[model samples]
Target: MRKFISRAAALLLAGVMTAAVAGCGKNSDSEAKDTAKKWTELDQTQITEAMGLGWNLGNQLEASSGGLPSETCWGNPEITKELIDTIKAQGFKTVRIPVSYLDMIGDGPDYKIDTDWLDRVQEVVDYVVNNDMFAIVNMHGDGYYTVDHSWLLCAEDDDKQTEIKDKYGKVWTQIADRFKDYDQHLIFESMNEEFNNDYGKPDEKAYDNINAYNQIFVDSVRATGSNNEKRWLLLPGWNTNIEYTAGDDYNFKIPTDKGCKADGKRIMISVHYYDPFNFTIDENKTAKTQWGKYAVKNYDNWGQEDYVDSQMALLNEKFVSQGYPVVIGEFGAQDKTEKFADYNEFRRYWSEYLIKAAKKNGVVCVYWDNGYNGNKGFGIINRFDYTITQPDLIAGMMRAINSTDDYEIPSPAGYTEVRKSAKAS
Candidate 1:
């Protein structure tokens, strides 16, 4: 399900201004910007392929329910090296750490991020990259939450554009400077899913504003010097929605970066997928509990393998083929609901098929996990034990990714081939 505001709350904040003043300043030392590019340089395509399977460390650092900035505020244990090591051991090559700076930054002209908070975030990034896994640090849940007075909402308003741009630039400047010496494996995502009713729709002004913000992000990071000059950056579309992002109506454009132009492609497009809401994310008691070609009941007519093929094909044609790699930053089917009996097998099929389709289309997908081990939670790893809770799901994903047999590539018109099995059915 989409994070941030409830549908009702979103409607209420449609026209409201919840802006809070923020102060900004350069807090990192000159030593932090030392010239050192550690990781081997790879183009965006190679980087995307290298990422393989990924998982999100969600509902922890992004939690702000109790007005606290600590990871434990949401009931998840403090992030530890063992947890990241376990993720690497489970075959996940990339870890996307979503963080919220709502309570970590000081209040308008100067929004300075707390040094300790920046240090804590760096520690987590180190845990992932130091373990040889790709890490993505993004500003998550920092936008569109009415209660938090999101600056992202201001990005869409013409009146507040200057203020929002200033804040956005300051935030990225701090982040880029702090991690200036980190290698290419540590990617900086400009924002999470920043969108609202009008801004998320097919509004030209909104698209223009979003593009401007992305430009600010790229310019700010590039200005930090050192490794950031050619660092990989991920830019999200409206609400990170695949349809809205890849569709013809959004007028989405990749921001230009002079620093990355000479080094080859350094910008990647990001989108989220949880299609067929009735099957993947709908929490209603009457929601469809089963899906896939082999399902005997509750099978969704849409969002089948063919649907996956078409959406992926759209991305490949629109961006991947044009030199920009695509990252499905968040995608998953929840298994915490009791509404479905014997749901694990069906969920496994979904995982395998999605990974296979994404691979065929040259896209990288990262599963979203909110660390809930109980009802409606998306946790796959047991945080308490630092172990994988669902072995079958992980095995299914690995098998799909490791399979050597190639499925026929689908055309823009439609999919025309049947999937072949390389393992026991």
Candidate 2:
């Protein structure tokens, strides 16, 4: 277990503010900015290969939840050495740490990310780099759920936007300055799930609003100094989902303010593949879909090369072919009641369709899973804590990504630390 850390909330200008929950500044000793500068040295090809078969370390962040987490929850005891080794052994080169900077914010719910929370977040990231794994740490559900990237949503007035931009500057300025020590392997995704919060509300703007906001996000992430100059950034389209991003009119032009560039080749475009969200998120009892039914276990759905081909056809035409690399940032259907399907089928197809396609094309895939719920065959295994699971799906995808399997990870090697240590020893 890693040493526990604390966090505080930084104050801000309400909806438009770039606020950090107030408290002492976080520990920046290890992740120096000078080191962060090295990221620019990495070109697009290196970024793409390193990102192939990336893994999403979910549930630790609460960006949409409005705050940050107590430092401890940011990994430490939760992430065992075995887990790290398993991911590495499976051929995954990157781990995307989804973080909510609000969970540990403020004294209560006044909205502040505790400073300790930041420290802990950094610690888990360190664990990834320490283990020889590339790490992609970024704002997560927190920025979407409670707050929903308020500034991007344009919740506040014009003046508020400027104020919030400054706040955004302060928030990332601190983060970049702190984690700057890590190598290019330690990447930073600008925002998570940049969707429209007011879909049908009184003040709903057209989807075009999301495009505008994305531009703002990119510009903001860049202004934080050279640390982010050429750092590989994952720029999610306005909604971060495929349908909208691939739409004809909603072109998310790469940002081009003074410092930004065109082609966005260095930046990977993120498009989540939960197309059948009802299937992935809803358990038959609620928003259920075919996901809980036969789609998961059978591998039949996954094996359907046609479905895979079609989806990628559309994706490549709409986005990938445009020159930017893509990533299935999130994908998984829930295994639940009413919607309950055989776990076997669920895993087979879901994995096949998502990971297989990601490999065939130039895209990277991230299975959306947390160390919760045992039935979620999607858990890589049936374990809730995510501590024990199979890496079959991960390995298969890795095989697809690399094309030629010069290095194949054996099954027995993925089980546990004891087994891994035994093998290595």
Candidate 3:
């Protein structure tokens, strides 16, 4: 499971980060000021294909407590360029860095991002782009659960909505300005998962506000000019859910980019897939451990291969078919390797099949690695050692990505009961 550091502990850590967090100096002069040089000539389809298989540097930069951001606050070591080099060596073509700028952001009207935090983020992005790989930097966790003055609330009180929008736009403006000169290799995602904090049916007003946020994000980034005017932007639907995003019910409008230099090809859709949460996450559940048709025991009856196909088809019909490429921003089954001896085998199967499905439907898939390497965790690589913890799973996924053969679902085997004590959350 992911670590949510206590506010007290975060406060203690914050004491050391005071200098870095408190400084709101002007942007550095090291940026490449050339806005005319074109880095990528690929259109949306080619750009999506270029992304290939992607990885998330999760739970690191996005880890925060009491509004203070710390890369190591959640038990992960400091991020090193070597860590990113290891990831690139493993065949990942893109790296998505989930970032949070809570207390790292100065008080409004400017909402200036702390200079140190912004530079640190740029340093990581450089690690990825230096390897000639696509890097996605996004506003993550600031829109998440109630904490750290998390203000990206789409369903804010009517009176407070202006403050939220103002903060959102100002923050994006600073982020865009900081990376304005970076090439097309650097992409900006509007927000991680901005919703009403409701898991039920989405609120129309909330959905409308999310659209407004996207528009603000697009306008704000474009206003920065430079390479950002044409930089590919990823937009998430309600909570980044496939159905809420592309399905008929919710309101998810793509932001209008009137002067986007990419010929209307700069916008991309972002959504996550964690269907049957009981299997992918929930540690309290004991039954849905193994997944897929061949799993004779401890598998979800639904969200099998057919469900994967249908969901991909939905995105293709609604988005991809119309020129907007859909990205499975996050998707993975957790490690229950200790709980079930054959768990990794099923994980390999799940990964392979999911990759095949995503590729078939013209979607890019980025695996979510939360940096934990045991039961209930979604890590595949040991971040500190830069070692592959789940070789078979990673291998299966790569094979699926490269394979052109038609994928066939395996026949279901007889069920076998396997139950374990639920771990306390």
Give the top-scoring candidate (lDDT).
3
Q: Per-residue CA lDDT of candidate 3, range 143-203, in tens?
A: 8765566878888777888988998999999888877777778889998877776778789
The number of the candidate with the highest TM-score is: 3
Clashes of each: 8, 60, 0
Tell me how far candidate 3 lies from the true structure as C-alpha RMSD in angstroms. 6.2
What is each predicted model's overall lDDT from 0 to 1? 0.73, 0.52, 0.78
Candidate 3 has which clashing residue pairs, if any?
none
Superior by lDDT: candidate 1 or candidate 2: 1
- Candidate that beats the other on TM-score, 1 or 3, i.e. the better one: 3
* Best-to-worst TM-score order: 3, 1, 2
Worst 10 residues of 2 by lDDT: 1-10
TM-score to native of every candidate shown: 0.86, 0.70, 0.89
Whole-structure CA lDDT of model 3 = 0.78
Measure candidate 1: CA RMSD.
7.0
**Residues 44-92, model 1: lDDT tens digits:** 6679778988999876676655344667655667889999998888889
Residues 62-96 of candidate 2: C-alpha lDDT, one tens digit per residue: 32322325322322225555666666666777787
Model 2 regions lying over 4 Å from their true place: 1-42, 63-68, 71-77, 80-82, 103-114, 145-162, 198-209, 257-264, 285-307, 336-341, 381-387, 395-399, 402-425
Q: Candidate 2 local accuracy as lDDT? A: 0.52
